[model samples]
Target: MAKQRIGIYPGTFDPITNGHLDIIKRGLRLVDKLVIGVATNPSKDPMFSLSERVAVVERETHDMAKVAGVEIDVMPFDELLMKFAERVGADIIIRGLRAVADFEYEFQMTGMNYQINPNIETVFLMADPRYQTIASRLVKEVARYDGNIEAFVPSMVASEVVKRVNESKV
Candidate 1:
């Protein structure tokens, strides 16, 4: 039997976007199971709750996971990513590099992750050109201004972003 290839792609995923789904699909090709970790960062208050983020991620990836024959689980975690990766028995850490700045940060983190667990390898996937400019922060900013985010996020998430924006206005 072959060894299981488990990959951990940890992010805030405030509201999982189509760009994220793209990375998940691509990551699935490299691993049998991909766990999308929604960061439960205590310091930063997100527009969407942790559960909401996880729910959207799960919903968006449900069909893709089934069709691609890759197991996908969306879970919330508050811990060092390396520790979370180790706890989940992940053999690979996946990061999506959209630009040079992202690479600089991820590159530093990848080195630290490797030091913590030499057995675990980090894989960087360049974002699809279409999504190269989509960032969650910018998405939220646009949604706050009632700008159309249909091109950046899934319909469900776009709705959630709108809902949250409206709630915040109240």
Candidate 2:
């Protein structure tokens, strides 16, 4: 029997934009199981707490997982990405590239990760043109200004972002 191919898609997922979902959907096609690693990245000044982000990710991905028939697991991590990947026994690390700017940073990280563990391979998926510019940071910025974010994030997440932004104002 063939071994189950497990892949890990790690990101801050501050508010999981459509671009992130695009990657997850495509990544699911390449692996039997996917572990969505929610990074505890304090550097990003996340609009949502770790638990909130996890909940949003889980909610947004539930239907996709079912439809794709791919097992999906969402978990929080606060350590090196490679270590987290190792802990999850992931042989593939899935990433999404939006532009050349992203490629430089990802290139460096991929090299560093390879040095740490050459056994695990990194796979890059180009973001769909429609979602190429939908980033969590930009989405949050729009939400902070009371601008529409429904186009960038899932409907439920858009509501959550608006609610969180309003609460932050109080």
**Per-residue lDDT over 1-170 for candidate 1, one digit per residue giving the tens place of the 0 to 100 score:** 99999999999987777788899999999999999999998566688888888888888889999999999988899999989998999999898999999999988998888888899999999999999999988999999999999999998788889988999999
| Candidate 2 clash pair list | none
The lDDT per prediction is: 0.90, 0.95
TM-score of each: 0.97, 0.98
Which residue ranges in model 2 land beyond 4 Å of their true spot?
none
- Tens-place lDDT per residue, model 2, 1-170, is 99999999999998998999999999999999999999999999988889998998999999999999999999999999999999989999999999999999999999999999999999999999999888899999999999999999989889989999999999
Separate clash counts for every candidate: 0, 0
Among these predictions, the greatest TM-score belongs to 2
CA lDDT of 4 in candidate 2?
Answer: 90
